[model samples]
Target: MNPRTMHSIFLKKKRTMVAIAMLSVGSISAQTFSDFSYKGNDKIYTNNPLKENEFYSPILQGCYPDPSITRKGDDYYLVNSSFSMFPGVPIFTSKDLVNWKQVGHVLDRPSQLKVEKGGVSQGIYAPDIKYNKYNDTFYMITTQIAGGIGNMVVKTKDPAKGWSEVQKLNFDGIDPAIFFDDNGKAYIVHNDAPPKGTEQYNGHRVIKIWDYDLEKDQVVAGSDKIIVNGGVDLSQKPIWIEGPHIYKKAGKYFLMCAEGGTGGNHSEVIFMSDSAKGPFVPATNNPILTQRYFPKDRRDKVDWAGHADLVETPDGKYYGVFLAIRPNEKGRVNHGRETFILPVDWSGKYPVFENGLVPMKPKLKLPEGVKNKTGKDGFFPNGNFTYIDKLTDKNLDFRWIAMRGPRENFITSAKNGVKVNPMETNIKALAPVSALFHRLQHEDFETSVSLDYKPKSEKELAGITCYQSERFNYVFGITKKDKDFYIVLERTEKGESKLIASEKITLSKAIKLQVIGERDEHQFNYSLDGKNFKNLGGPVSGDILSTDVAGGFTGSLIGLYSTSSNDIKP
Candidate 1:
């Protein structure tokens, strides 16, 4: 063949290869898996046996920020920023860091806080937990910013039951961390906004360590000594430093903290000092874990990763538990600030990043001697009678949280399952008092609630809702139209509620509706006998259920709701 003919054939082959590559990219992009899914029925507990030199960690779910963990004997306890969400300061326990169970809340009573309209983002900030061997007490310091209150401490021998009345710590700052040295002395470290007139709560701040009086519940000595001042550095502009946890190991004090904003640029920085109060030295290799170091390939970009705490295992292994966000197709992260565990190694006198500079994805290894029994209740367990009993526990699962702050008389125990009374408030105002909900725990899980509703008036609405917020919500309930039974599906976006789907239906003395939420999709089905079902196909679309769009301090919740112009009495 001539040279011209060969050139033409080469061009054709190049064009064909380019087309195939583009098709492959399109196919890969078209198919993506949901972040949270049912990972089969594997019983992996926190304390299960581990092979030698094996790494184990937890699948950090929800918004767990400013994580403070303490190891008491072989057991570990962890707490995060509850913000305004009630049952504040969720306390989790695990024999190992891998598997954690919701033990209880540090604050259960209303007197602990008066957060009515702060929504979910204003109640509690990062809290530090410590065990006082001298008094044999567990001390926790939480910051309540909505009330402009200083830090408050709660003590108890047992954390699972309840805590004492909050002992007010008269200190001004946000993320409060408590450090107990081996010398029987305690110090409190926190980030304070620049005096009063300087600026608002911007980044330019410092970690101040003060001699704290546990008995007096106040800072006894030491001025606000600027320990590590990253906020002053001009290079890292808009320096928002917070979430400081102090750990003393091998005669060197490590101040591990979250720097930059809690959003995409969030990071975990480590500093070292010879004493509790320091001219702390920045770790030669700072920002031990961050997205800047952990690059995302073609899969997903896990951003806003920081706010970490270091925990040592029973067998002397160091692990860091921190929060990170996984973005969706729209570049939004619904599973906000999830907790993750990565191993850390000691190099020379300081800690070094494992697996080069990139964040190490170590193989998870369960601890020795534990049991995990997840998903033994069979698929679609809403109809299972035993599963219904588990939902009524006063210790509400981490899967559940109130849309607004929870009211005292909102939810009560009924003979059947749970009873939610209507509050005398519209869904638009502060403390709607009408909604109770749980997190959309699984992507493809089915949730159904049985409630016998007798609408007192045309305004009263009671039913089950998948609520992200007031503006973005889907409600399925019985509307009082000519006293006729009808199931209605309402969708709200940008504070506007539109009736998406409604159908007339016959109901017996009782009514039940089950919502099957698929991968980024939802379906509402009604059943009178709880056996046979009718599919109500009125699909709703909004970002409220998607964590990336509805920006709040908490996750999506599914629960019973009742709204009324007058007070609802059961």
Candidate 2:
């Protein structure tokens, strides 16, 4: 059979596998998930809904940034950066490229991820997952910013199963991606600072390529070379040229990278060369994908778009997955950088992201015959949807995540929900806390939970936290204030904690605590009975939970938090 014809058949088979996997995913969840991690029976209803023949542009949302895609024949896998959050490097699978199901984290085991002592933003960064057909193995290469483990790679025949131990690479850079040539030679592409004293300006980075030894899983000695410097044009003084990936197509080598930092000026630029390690030349029409040129107030605006990876389908079509932010009405990024996809017009000499230059529409038309299964079956949810997790499933949902340690470390299934054993470290500490977090997915939303707890002492507290990081967050929970139990709301900004409000409460029964996020503000409420809610704090500014104010690469996380080192005095 012809290669193209075989790929078509393989796609059909893979599509069928996806359907079966979606329908039967919950049945096999126990084999993958740890049950009842912090009891987040959440219901999120966003305002963006899909229209006919359309799906959401952000195939994955809420801090899922720096998306890299890889293809093995008809099957596709996508991965993202996971900084400090334990079980780093979230990996997902898709057949149609629209619907995605998280197979699991790439660094799922404690031995694979050692971020326990690193800051909240110092774990995995910009992981690139690529399938090497030469060995029939998948390689996930990334930079671990913690524990002195710099650039690393892990391999596995199947992604759904657990991955191998980390193979630390001998390099000092960020965002390392491995590319395998057709002749079985592999190369490593990454962004690094220019050779010492060669720095012409700040943020002056270069893209370098090295011959990768397949047998040793190391970059070949003395084979590294600089392919691109100072981005597309030297006169422009381009900043932060990073997140590089190489592709070999039609006997030509393409090196795509994100330029101008990760904020508003961010963009994807392309360069081509005849050889893998090359004197590559920038494309005449560069910045193949960007949202910075559009007006800031454009309707349904998407901004800070860059850090992309591309993949070609079996039918000769191309798509680019990148990170972009959807700022709230107050012009703050509470949603952080999300994963968005756009079709590529690669028919020309250069691949341009179609509809990528303009203000992005929330929806994309589905491929010819692929049905949209988002929010249904086992695929990841997007657009306008209401997701309800009842805290009763035998297996934990893949959506639940923790920081610095595995969710299993502090959570246990008991009494129809998760029992969080309060850790010595508090939410304000750099170390791991006893909390399970779900991303703050929507700008305007309400997240509520029932907590049956009576503080035995002032040090023990259990409640909900709207956290941007350890330095900036809000802690609302039950704590004993001098022999009296009270529900207190505390705000921590830049490592300083201030009491926002406190209510003396009788600990007679289970109480429902809720946090309502309304784009610019958040409201804390409590209900003695499940339905009757009384506001604890009228409204608090959401500035602390925004990336713009907090100054981090991550978005706000809504955590079911419990801690034994409580320091908030109310």
The residue-by-residue lDDT of candidate 1 on 113-227, one tens digit each, is: 5567765567888888887777777888879866556688877787775677767776677788888888888888888766557553456776777887767767785455768
Q: For model 2, state the Cα shift of residue 159 in Å.
A: 0.5
- The TM-score of candidate 1 is 0.80
- Best TM-score goes to which candidate? 2
lDDT of 2 by residue, 1-570 (tens): 432344345445644654554455332211111121222111222344555687878888789989999988778999999899976888899999988999878887767788988877788999999999888999999999988899999998888776778899988889999999999999999999999999999999999999999999999889999999889997889999999999888999999999989999999999999999888999999888888887777877789999999999999999999999988778989878999999999887788999888788887899888899987888988765556665656356777889998776666555466656677799987787878898877777777777877777787788889989999999988888887988899999998888989989887777788887776888999887778998986899999999989997998898888877888777
What are the TM-scores, per candidate, against the unseen true structure?
0.80, 0.91
Model 1 deviation from native, Cα RMSD in Å: 18.0
Question: Best candidate per lDDT, number?
Answer: 2
Which residue runs of candidate 1 sit more than 4 Å off their true CA positions?
Answer: 1-60, 195-202, 231-234, 293-297, 352-363, 368-408, 432-434, 528-537, 566-570
